[model samples]
Target: MFFNRQEIKFMFDENKRLNSKVKEFAKKNFHPKNFLFFSDSGSGKTTIAEKLAEELAKRREICYKSNDSKFIDYTNQEVLVKQELIHNTWLLKELLNLCEKDICPMNCKGKTKIDVMTKYNIITAQDPFDDIFNFKKRIFDENPAYSKDKRIGLHRRFSKSKDYTHGYMFKVTNRYQSGKVDFQITCLKESDDSAGDINDFVNGRFDIKFAEETTLEEAKKRVYDDDFENLYKHKGDVFLKREVDMDHVLGGVICDVDTENHTFSVYNKYFDSEIPSTMIPPKDLNRLNERLRNKIINQFGPDHEITGTNKRT
Candidate 1:
């Protein structure tokens, strides 16, 4: 909700564009591919990427059951849905299952568990880069029980499969709330053999870059200004003047307007507390009550009681 409708739409479209590029590569190469997205903290990259993942999973007939934390592949009834309690373990099991048969995992009977991992998979590995190396070793080199021919078959199936889709989310800049690890290092290493930088997919590198950063305070101010403008158009200057004067007298910021209580709450930064409407001047308080009463009358055909205003309506 921090972004407006148009902003949200653009974010979704941009991610879809990136996904399309991955799909195009998969189609042409007949191999699985992944993507990496980098942006500053609080840029909503995770939100947008997760949404695209969910959408793609649904298209692939894969859905996640939150109660059991398992991704169910509705298309493949034979494969059991595994609970994703451990990332590395879950990934290992899925890949091992794919290797159970010699056929390409992409053209197998049903969608793979990797298809339903909307949150984070190998593509978004936040752990150390060694984890990836360990995974490769486990799959192809570490296991001694399997014959050399079996290991080679597994590697061929995995490398040739065109069904895998993954995305990596990385923050270009760190903030107070962001993690300290540099994910770009992992992303670059992962993409070294897969798809190149995102800019390679889209023409004009500027199109792939994120917009200018907007701070939380600046976003809130934009919402406040839009609300104030709309309210002024409806209620005129008298109501607006009283609201401003009340803010000045209370020496606090108007945090919220509680229409149901017929009061506007103010937050005093000095004391870190909210000032009650009782602290407002009697004249301004009366004007606010009158405004609410008029609003109720005009909305409810002038038959509603003065104290019977419903905020929901």
Candidate 2:
């Protein structure tokens, strides 16, 4: 029999309660662990993630960004989407502080760039800066200024110390993981500020980490193994271990997607043999392990049972 008015109201209320419960469960318990969304370039992963993030944000869960280095100093304030989003900056305000002294061209004129070159121990400058700065050299090839000791007595000084310039300080990071990522985040470092070191990145201190477009083996070696785990134990960084027991089944974006053609591969880690070898996941995710799945088919016919995302339906 059909329900009456009161029963219908009660049913509606119960349905609402169940829907709310499902949302809560998904928000709390549902984690996409080593899960890959097989989609094309315009398949709308970010669009879906955006809607999901907005819902999660309203729940007040701690979802900060891990990409920006500029926000490290201002960690206390701001409801940051990405914590390190702005931390690795060479703050222009620092130059304002430097300008409190006498007129300095490097600080007063244009954009000042700084870098920590691993090959070069000493930091150099484009515009001549500092108080004790002097003309180093301006030796011409044909008409060489060999006797170039003007102050000492023989020749004139070639370059003058630039004393009136301005600049806005800025800091940068390694290339981002993807075009869709909004988080400009980075992590805390134990060493001095160094720009764009792969070691610094793989160390994984920042909120958002990026796996650059590189070799599959290289990505696997950096994210997995003893050294990475050590950083986990010491730095308290997030560790999402991807355990696999398959060959050529590395986990990442299923590169070169032609789903209609039924060909794809992940760039994470896979096995060459029985051992965990470094390689991409098999191009054909549809390929069934006849030996392994045979147990199921023995009980029931091959076409009767349903398989999960682990293998193709």
Top-lDDT candidate index: 1
Give the per-residue lDDT digits (tens) of candidate 2, residues 173-263.
Answer: 1122331111111111222222222211112112211122333343334332442432221132232232222221111222232223223
TM-score between candidate 2 and the true structure: 0.16
Q: Pick the candidate with the highest TM-score.
A: 1
lDDT of 1 by residue, 1-313 (tens): 3999999999999999998887421111112223333444443334434443433233333332222223333333211222222233333334443323211232223444333212212122233223333434245444224344433432332221221222222333333132111223122322222222322111101111111243334323322244343222121111111112322222232323333322233333332222332322222233233443343345433443223221112
Can you tell me which runs of candidate 2 are displaced by over 4 Å? 1-193, 207-313
Q: List the residue pairs that clash in candidate 1.
A: none
Let me know the TM-score candidate 1 reaches against the reference structure. 0.27
Each candidate: how many clashes? 0, 43
